[model samples]
Target: MSAQVIAIDAMGGDFGPRSIVQASLACLSATPSLHLTLVGQPSLLEELLSGQSAADRARLTIMPASEVVTMDEKPAQALRGKPDSSMRVALELLRDGKAQACVSAGNTGALMALSRFVLKTLPGIDRPAMVAAIPTQKGYCQLLDLGANVDCSAEHLLQFAVMGSVAAQTLGIARPRVALLNIGTEDIKGNQQVKLAATLLQAARGIHYVGFVEGDGLYRGEADVVVCDGFVGNILLKSSEGLAAMIAARIEALFRKNLASRAVGALALPLMKRLQADLAPARHNGASFLGLQGIVVKSHGSAGVQGFQSAISRALIEIQENLPERLHGRLGDLLS
Candidate 1:
């Protein structure tokens, strides 16, 4: 396969270009077929790149961007005032075909707005949804509309199911079982919107809709893809992340309680590390903006080097599988 070129909004995240530069270099060393274009202040990026080996630097390019969209800025304001922002520049690169994918740990609203303006949506998609992988008992479950659309109709929910199912297939699931996120698993449960979505999903072709799944079913691996409106999905994602962090902190507190506990901790150190790795938010930091004509991966704004790298990896996988193209074809067939 040919090399995949990716553009990164180097100034987007909390750590600015420092973390992004380090992660980009690391990704280049790890993947021989990967090339990166870092978009940010040229001076800052150059300072960060200082002392890097020539060969490693060969695979990386810098595109100077004058402004940055702050995390708190409104999406409309940023779009109108900061055309030269790193986030916007990176998306422009994708639009121009200079990069196969773009990754950003920036303002979610601004990123989504800019991406929609620059890349547009696939033919049958009215809006692009945020889709992400959530760790589950069996392995992982794909969930969609994670804070993109605050209000969604039944048709929107059905669209999320279709897009999510296509994404699961790209991730190696042959026939993914799909489900609606509802209050109960019964045939007549949830709000009217969810109930209506269920009807559409059951009749939709090219998707394996298996009915409704509750919040608990998400972690139980009861279904491969869980569909919900952005309002509910965003709340669920934040709550899950917060719970994971609390559990990890409590575990550490327990181990540090006394000398006796410390000794016990030593014995269980390996198991604890494994659990931490699996539950760490950084490991699953990337979320894809599905239904866009081009691939865009949204890294958590506060992500560190490791987290940003995970986002890059997510983009690479989507690019390799030609996710957008596959989704377009599938939706076309289903609609036809």
Candidate 2:
């Protein structure tokens, strides 16, 4: 029998199960083999699932979960105390071979912590990294260790490169060129971590390490995979988010200024749509917690229906491609 792709942790993210359930239903209609098991309290999921077609009702199954790990809750505290939490339950399904993959938009720290506690890592993986897809002039780029490990060693950075390379290949790149994020393009630049990581990456086999890459060089299509510590990556991700929002707000203000400006807005709408489409976060919704035994996609906390759908769709693609086994074969030695 074919594997089932069900969404666990129904009550996660800002939108919660309303958006999640809606997206899961939409995904079921779009993909036949995809079945949805919304893991949450029956009351909440039943409310969300109301007014749906019999077909959708048939495709979805609700498993009772008593607790939810909130965004503010600490990961360690939640894991120890909240035994029936939705995230934990969802992960258990994956571990027990009942679910092929899981997607969550909850507290990232909690998700990572729970994933580690419940799913554990594949052999030789010291730590798992969060990889998010970012827009670039050359289409898209994947940045790793978004918030998985705040502090990393040289070996961890090299693993990020290997994992990122596999991810880039999955996205259609032949052999993703990796660039260690640093203060300068020089080999000896940046802090001790980058310097040490650069040496290791340059000497590493089966990866294309294109030397050091400065912050400003990221968007210029300098490399397909940008490797850095989680702290730096999180800051970079937030900064780009702020920049995109600021630019969008400025454009909206300009369009409302005057009659001529409004007319100009109409003329510029197509170009704006093109740019928006190119940089839309919803287009790249699935960021894998790399090095896990099975796929665990994390969507943005504020992800709406579209972003949630993209996350589910991406999960399906990853499973269909056997991304985990492929990466293991490629980086097994280095991970060892």
- Please give the lDDT score at residue 187 for candidate 1: 80
- Evaluate residue 256 in candidate 1 and report its C-alpha lDDT on the 0 to 100 scale: 86
Best by lDDT: 1
- Per-residue CA lDDT of model 2 for 185-298, tens digit only, reads 866678888888888887788888898877778888899999998989888877776677677678877898876788788777666555554454433476788888888888
Cα lDDT tens digits for candidate 1, 1-336: 899999999998777778889999999999999999999999989999998989989999999999999999999988899989999999999999999999999999999999999999999888899988888889988888899999999988988899999999999999999999999989888899999998888789878999899988878999999999999988988877677667767777888887688877877666655554445443445889999999999988877888899999999999999999999999998756
Which 10-residue span in candidate 1 carries the lowest summed lDDT?
Answer: 275-284
CA lDDT of each prediction against the hidden true structure:
0.89, 0.82
- Could you tell me the lDDT of residue 8 within candidate 1? 96
| Residue 298's lDDT in candidate 1 | 91
- Models 1 onward score TM values of 0.95, 0.94
Which portions of model 2 miss their true places by more than 4 Å? 267-284
